[model samples]
Target chain A: MRTLYQFHGGVHPAEHKQESSAHPIVMAPLPTQLIVPLQQHIGQRAKPLVQIGDRVLKGQMIGQADGATSCAVHAPTSGSVSAIEMMPMPHPSSLPDLCISITPDGADEWITRTALDYQNMNPGEVRNRLRDFGLAGLGGAVFPSHVKLNPGKLDKVPTLILNGAECEPWITCDDLLMRERAAEIIAGAKIMQYLLSADAVLIGIEDNKPQAIAAMRAACAATGFEVIAVPTRYPSGGAKQLTKILTGKEPPSGGRSTDIGVQIFNVATAYSVARAVLHGEPMISRIVTVTGNVEQPRNYEVLLGTPVKELVALTGKQRNDTQSYIMGGPMMGFALPTDNVPVIKASNCLIASSPSLFPAPPPALPCIRCTQCAQACPVNLQPQDLYWFSRGREFGKAQEYNLFDCIECGCCDYVCPSHIPLVQYYRFAKSEIWAREREKQQADLARERHEFRLARIEREKKERADKLAAKTQGSKAPAANADIDPKKAAIQAAIERAKLKRSGVTPKNVENLSVETLKEIDEIEARRTQLKQAMEKQSDSPK
Target chain B: MSTALLIMIGLALFLGLVLGYAAIKFKVAESPLVQKIDAILPQTQCGQCGFPGCKPYATAIASGEADINQCPPGGEEGIHKLAELLGVDPKPLNAEHGVPKPKSVAVIDEELCIGCTLCIQACPVDAILGAAKHMHTVIAKECTGCELCIPPCPVDCIQMQVVQEDLTTWKSKYPLHEIRNV
Candidate 1:
C-alpha cells in the first residue's frame, strides 16, 4: 500500500454524489439547433471555418485552432450551419461570443476517420494529430491537452496523475465516467502515459466513490498503472493537492505540475484522448452530471453546444422551488445567467439550484479575524488579509500577499463565519489585477507610439527648416550679385579712361571751347606737362 | 588624559572618512521627480491640464507651478497617486478642468472628412493617420482617448465615441446575486 501525504488545509463538503452516480451514463438526444461557441477553451479563440448554409458532418472541424495554445472546435452532429454570430455564452460574465448555430439533419452522419497506431508513430506526430482533434482538459480548465503533453524542455516526466476525485459537491461526472467506462479510461491513460513517457501512472480517486475506485482498480490491475484511493476531502481533487497526496511533492507557487516532473489530467480527458487516438473521434460530447431539483437526476452524455435548458428538461421537470442552475460543482461553479447558454467542453455538471440545496447566504457582517478562513485555505494563504486588501482596493498589497496563488476553491468562503463571500472578493481582485495589467500594457504601447510621433514631428520640422534655408540662400545669391555689378561697372569705366589717356585722343568738343575755357585748359595742360616731366625725371634717376 | 583624548579624536576622524566613502560608494541614482510624476499621469496629452503634454504637466507639478488635481484624464485616482508620491494630501479633481468621463477615442467620419489635416496636427498623440485631402483614420490602439482633435476638424466629421466593453475587456463587477435581488 502506498502511503499518501497531506496538504496544509482542506474542508469536508457534502459529497452529494449518490444523486447522479447511481444511474449509468445515458446519451442525450441531439438538439434541433446546436450553438457551438468559437471560444470554448482558454487562450485564443478558434477561427470559424464554416459559413452559413454550409453542410457539416458530425465531428467535422468547424473552428480551426488559432495559435499554439488553442484547440479546434467540432460539430456535435451532422448539421447545416444556420447562423454564425455573437450569442450569449456560458460564462460567469454572461458575455456574448461568436457561435456557430447548426440545425441537425437527423442523419447523424460522420466524417471519415482513420485510427492511428500511436505506438508505432513518432510521439510528436501523435501529439499534432491530437491537437486538431479538439482534445482539451475536460477538468473545468479546458486547457489544450496537446500543449500539456509536451512538458517543454523537461526531458522526462516521472509521474502522470489522473484525477478521478470529484471532490466538489453535486459534481460526479468523473465518478460516473470511472464507474461505467473504467476500461476505456485506462486505455486512454495508457495512451497519455506513452505520449508523456512517464515512468509511473497514478489515478487518484476520492474514497467517497468506492464503486468508481473498485472499477478503476480492477481495470488497471494487471497494468503498471496504480489506482490509489485518496481520502475524501473537499478540493483533494485539486491538481496540486492530488499531486501532493500521490507523489509527496507540492508544485511551486505560480508553477506547473510539469515543473515537478508530474502532470495531471481528468479521467474524462484521458477517455477523450483514448477516443481521439484509437478511434479517431474528435471530442464532441462529454458526460455531464445534470442533478438537483429535477425529477430524474442523472449523468447524461451531453453533446457539445447543447442548450442547458434542453438538457435540464431531460431530467424531468424542474421543481417549482428551483431558483437557478449552476454549471459546475457547488464550490467552484457559478450560477448560469440564463438557461439559453450552450454547454461547452469544460462543463462537467449542471445543478438545478433550489432554496434547500443552496440557501441564500445571509448578509455579510464585519470580519472579526478569527482566522477560521486561514485554517480552511487549501493554499495556506492568509485569507483575512487578502479580504481586507481586496475590499480596500489595495491591489498592490493583495498581490504582495500572493493573491494569484488562490485556487478559488471556495474553502475560505465555506469556513468564513462572517459570510463575507470571500471567493467573490478574490475573483474581483483577480479581474481588477488583470484589467490593470492590460491597462499598463496599453499605456506602455501608447507611450512608445507617442514618443515615436514626437521624434518624427521633430525630424520633419528640421527638414522643413533646412529646405527653407536653402531656398532663401538661392534667392539671396542674385541680390548680392546685383550689388556687386555696380562696383564692376565703375572699375570698368576707370580702366576705359586710362586707356583713352594712353591713346592721346582729344575730342572735337575740347578743341572748340571758349577763350576763357581755352585759358583754363592751357593752365591744366601746363600743369599736366609739368607732372609728366616730373614722372620722367624720377624714372631717369632710378636708372 | 591628554594622550587618550588625542587618540579618540583621530579615531573619530578616520571613521568619518570611511562612513562618507561608503555613502558615496553605495548611493542610489534616483529617477528625477519630473519623470516619476509623468509616470503617474495618463499620457493622453489632451492639454486639459493647461500644458502641451503629460511630460510638461509633470514638469509643472514637479516645479510646484501646477496643482496635482489638474488632470481630468487621470481623475481622482491620479491625484491620489501624485499625492502619495509627493507626500502631500490628495485633493479632488479641479472642476475648472473637464469632468472625469468614461474613456473615449475619437472616430473620424471618413466620407464627411474633406481630407483636412487639421485634426492630425491638433492630435497630441498623433493617432490620426492621413494626408491632406485624404481620408483619415484613427489607430484605435494608439489613441489615448484625448479629445484634442475634435475642435480642429474643419468639416465637424470627428466624433468622440465611448469605448464599448466587449468580452475581452469585460470584467464581472460583482456576483450576480449581489447586483440583482434574485
Candidate 2:
C-alpha cells in the first residue's frame, strides 16, 4: 500500500497516559441508577418516548429522534423509569436539563437484538441502521455519524482516514482500546470503509505509541488496510489537520473532508460502528480515561449513563474542594461544573488535578514585543494583530486576519511571556459576532412579519369590500335573488336551527360572511368556544 | 625649501581652523526627553506630582529623582500611561504620597469649616480661594486632589469619595495576551 503524507504545525505536550494505557480496559460494575440526558449529540434533542413508571430493557429505544438532524437514545440497562425531569447537566453554566432517570434491574441482561448485513445493505439501509443504533462520532465533536457517512452528493469517496492520534494530554482510552482490541477497531475501520464505499483506507497513529502502531499494523496485515505512523504532534488528532496529514489534501476552512472524497472517523467510533453493525449491539457504553492527580488513574469501560462522581470515586480521588475538574484535557477541555452529569458519547477523559499541580494563572503583563506567539501559532496568523484588533473591538479587522482559523489550541497562550489569555479574547469576539448576526436575523424576521401582516390586512379589507358590494347588488336586482327562493330558504332555516342546537358554531353568522372568511372565522370561533368550555369543565372538575 | 615650509604651515593652519569651526557650529542638545515629558503632562499647573508644579515633577522624573507611582490625583491609570512612555511596568501607587480617590477635587464643608487660611497656604496649585477670616473654598477646576489641603484643615472637612461606576468607566478585563510586533 502507498504511504500517506504529513502536515505541519503541532506541539508535543507531556502525554501522562502510561497509567491508563498500561492496562486493558475493564468493564465497570453497574451502578444502581443511570441518568441519561436526551440531548447528547450535536444536533436537536431527542424526544422522550417512554414516560415515568414504564419498564425498559437494555438496548431498548427509549427516546426517539426529534428531527432530521438528531439521533435516538437507548436504554443502557434494563430498568424502570423513576422520573423524567430536569437535572444538572455537564455544562460550563451548570444548567439543568430534562433527563431520564432509571432504576437498574441489576441483572445486567440484554434485550432482544438482531444484526443486519451492513456490507450488503444499500446506502439508505446503512444510514437507517446507523440512526437506529444511535451512533455518533465518538471524536469529541459528537456529530451524528450517519450524516457524514451519507454525503449529499453521490460521488464515490476515494479514501477513509482513521484517527488514533490521541494527541491530547492524559487521554489514553483510544490507546488502551487499540492495545487490547486492535482487531475490533480494524474491523470497525472496514465497516466504515464499506459504509463510505471508499477504495482505500488509512489509519494514522502518532509514532509515540509504538505499541498501538504495532498492534494496528498486525491487525492490518490480514485486513489489507494500511496503518501509517505519523510523527507525534499535539493537534495532529484534529480531524482537519489529521486528514491533511494523511492524505496531503487541505479541506477548505469551513468544509468537511467528504468534500474532498475523504471521510475520517475515530478508532473508537469505528469500533462502535462495527459492533453495532455486526454484533447486533447498540452503543450502550464506552471506555473512559480517568487520569490526573488521582491515586489510581485507569481506563474503565463504563456504561453510557454512568455519573462522573462514580468514575472519580473508582479512581480513588477526593472530589470535594478540588482545584478543578476538566472534561477532556487541560488545554482544550471545559471546566465541568458538577460531577453528577453522566458520561455521554462525547466524553473521552476526565482530569481532576489539584490547585498545587495546576495553580491559578498569575496576573498578566503587557507584551514585550517578542515574536514567540506568532512563531507558535499553528494557523500562521499574527497573534499580535489579533490581540490588538480584538482589544479595540475591531472585530472586522480581526476577521480579516484569519482569526477563525485559530483552533484555540492554547499553544500561543502556553508559551506567551506575558501570560495573556489569548484564547478567551478570541472566544469572546467570536461569540459577540454570532450574537450580532442573530440580532440582525431577528430584526429581519420582525420586518418580514410586519410586512406580511400589513399585506394580509389589505387583502382581507379588499375582500370584505367586494363582498359588501356583491351583497348590495344581490339585494337590488331581482335576478340575483331568484336562486334564494322559498324552498331553499326553508332548507337554510332548518340548517340554522340545527346548528344553533349544536355547540360548535351558530349558523346565523355564516350567512352574513363570504364562504372563505366564514369558514376561517367559524374555525377560530369554534376553537375559542371549545377552549372556554374546556376551561369551565376543568374548573368544575375535582382537583 | 621655503615653499615646502610655507605649504606645510598652510595645511596645518587650515586643519586647525576647520576643527575649531565645526566644534563651535554643531552642538546637539543632551537629554532632550525632559521637554517631551513636560509636553505630555496635563499642564493644569495643578502641582499634583509632589514637586512645586508640573515642570518640576517632569524634571525630577527625567532626572530619576522621583518615582513614577507618586501622583495621587493622576491615579494608577495616569501612572500606567506614564510607564508606557517611560518603558517600564506601572508599579502600584505608593501609599505614602496619597491615596487615589474620585475625580472630585475638594469641597469645603462650609458649616464645619473654621474659616481658616491654613488650607490656602497648603494648596500647592493655589487652588483654594479665601482670606484670613473667611471659609476657604476650593476652586474645583484647579484643585488636583493631591490631598495637600486635607491635612492642613483644622476642622477636617475635606473628603475624597470615589466616582461611581458608569458607562465610560466599564472596561473589560484586560486581554490575556497582548502580542506586539518587534
Q: Chain A TM-scores, one per candidate?
A: 0.86, 0.86
lDDT (C-alpha) at residue A148 in model 2: 77
* Candidate 1: regions farther than 4 A off: A471-543, B1-31, B174-182
Instruction: Give per-residue CA lDDT, model 2, range A1-543, as digits (tens).
Output: 555665555567777778677777888888778988887888888899999999899998888877778888889999899999888777655566778988998876687778787767787888877887888888788888888787566656888889999888889988888888899898888877777778898888888799999999998996778888887877888888788788788877666688788888899998898888878788889989988778878899988888888878887747555766798877788778788888889889888877875777777777676867787766677888887888777777888888888888887787788888877777667766664454345334433433354466689999999999987876677665686775578799999988778977666755767788978988999999999999999999999
Worst 10 residues of 1 chain A by lDDT: A478-487
Question: What is the RMSD, in Å, between candidate 1 and the native fold over all Cα?
Answer: 20.7
lDDT of 2 at A140: 88
Tens-digit per-residue lDDT, A225-343, candidate 1: 99999998988989999999999998888898988899999999999999998898999999999998889899999999999999999998668998889999899999998999999
Q: Cα miss at A496, model 1 (Å)?
A: 48
Q: Highest TM-score: which candidate?
A: 1
**Span of 10 residues, lowest total lDDT, candidate 2 chain A:** A442-451
What DockQ values do the models have?
0.29, 0.03
Candidate models: Cα lDDT each: 0.90, 0.78
How far does residue A383 in candidate 2 sit from its true spot (Å)?
3.1
Model 2 spans with C-alpha error above 4 angstroms: A1-6, A317-321, A468-543, B1-182
